[model samples]
Target: MSDWRASREAVELARLGVSELLANVAKHTASRRCGLRLVRVGADVVVQVFDESKQLPVVRTPDWCSEDGRGLWLLREMADGFGYMPIPLVTDTSYRLGKVVWFSCWGALPEAGAA
Candidate 1:
């Protein structure tokens, strides 16, 4: 993030979002293993978590009193954009259905004109 000149606030938000998304996978999915990817596209940074489960994440009304079920809601509220999509998990032996949940922090890179 520092290499890309992301603001402190953006870095913090990205960290929090990753934690929340991974936590959700551990709590809800049958498989504990997942894949994580981070990419920089122009001035934006996108983070994605790939899980074997085909189920898409749902953003529900967060229960302030509860410890669970608030991650996705908070992520959606904080990130510049967030989404999930069904993807093909192609392995050497088989093809499986999976999903990737992603969130983007816009302007994570400094503008070309900025010093």
Candidate 2:
């Protein structure tokens, strides 16, 4: 993870984004389980959450006092990239189908001679 140039602040933001994604799965999806993956592509760290839900998440303009529907928005603001992909199930399973929602955080480069 450190090889990706992930700063302290970036790692924290990534954690928050993943937490929101999992919360959404627990609250919205019918599946009882989910998967999370963190990977580095170049200078960016990608956080992915997988769940058995064909319904894609939508970005909404919630009321100022509303407590819900802000997770994706927060992720969009914090992460450099955010998106989802539907996975087709080839075998019979309880989930049947699923989706993978992902967000990427661009890591900050270290200053020369700082370390």
Candidate 3:
């Protein structure tokens, strides 16, 4: 994980972003199951969450006293880039519409021979 970036803070922030994405899925989606994928794309570590819902997540400003609706906002601030893409559904009856929410953190690649 540290290979993607020398800063431990960046890795931690990416983890938090993924957690928030999953939490949003559990709180808002009709489907209880979700998928998570992490990979190094170019100079960024991309965290993606796949959920069986076509609805795109909205980033909204919450009141200072509010207890909810700040997850995406925090993700946007922490990640270098964040967005969602709709997955095309198959014609098969077993398939359902879904989307993938992703966040990427940019940084230098891990040093050679480092784990």
Find the candidate with the highest lDDT and give its number: 1
Cα RMSD (Å) per model? Answer: 1.4, 3.4, 2.6
Higher-TM-score candidate among 2 and 3? 3
TM-score of each: 0.92, 0.81, 0.83
lDDT of 3 by residue, 7-36 (tens): 687778877887799889989998878888
- Kindly report which residue pairs in candidate 1 clash with one another: none
Task: By lDDT, rank the candidates, best first.
Answer: 1, 3, 2
Superposition error at 59 for model 3 (Å) = 0.4
Q: Least accurate stretch of 10 residues (summed lDDT) in model 2?
A: 106-115
Residue 63 local lDDT, model 3? 72
Q: What is the C-alpha lDDT profile of model 1 across 1-115, one tens digit per residue? A: 8877888988999999999989988988999789999898878899999999998888999889996778888899999999999999998999999999999999888876678
Q: Lowest summed-lDDT stretch of 10 residues in model 1?
A: 106-115
- Report the lDDT tens digits of candidate 2 across residue range 1-115: 4655568888788778878998899999888588888876656678888887888898776566986777788788777888988986555544466888998877544544446
Which candidate, 1 or 2, would have the higher TM-score against the true structure? 1
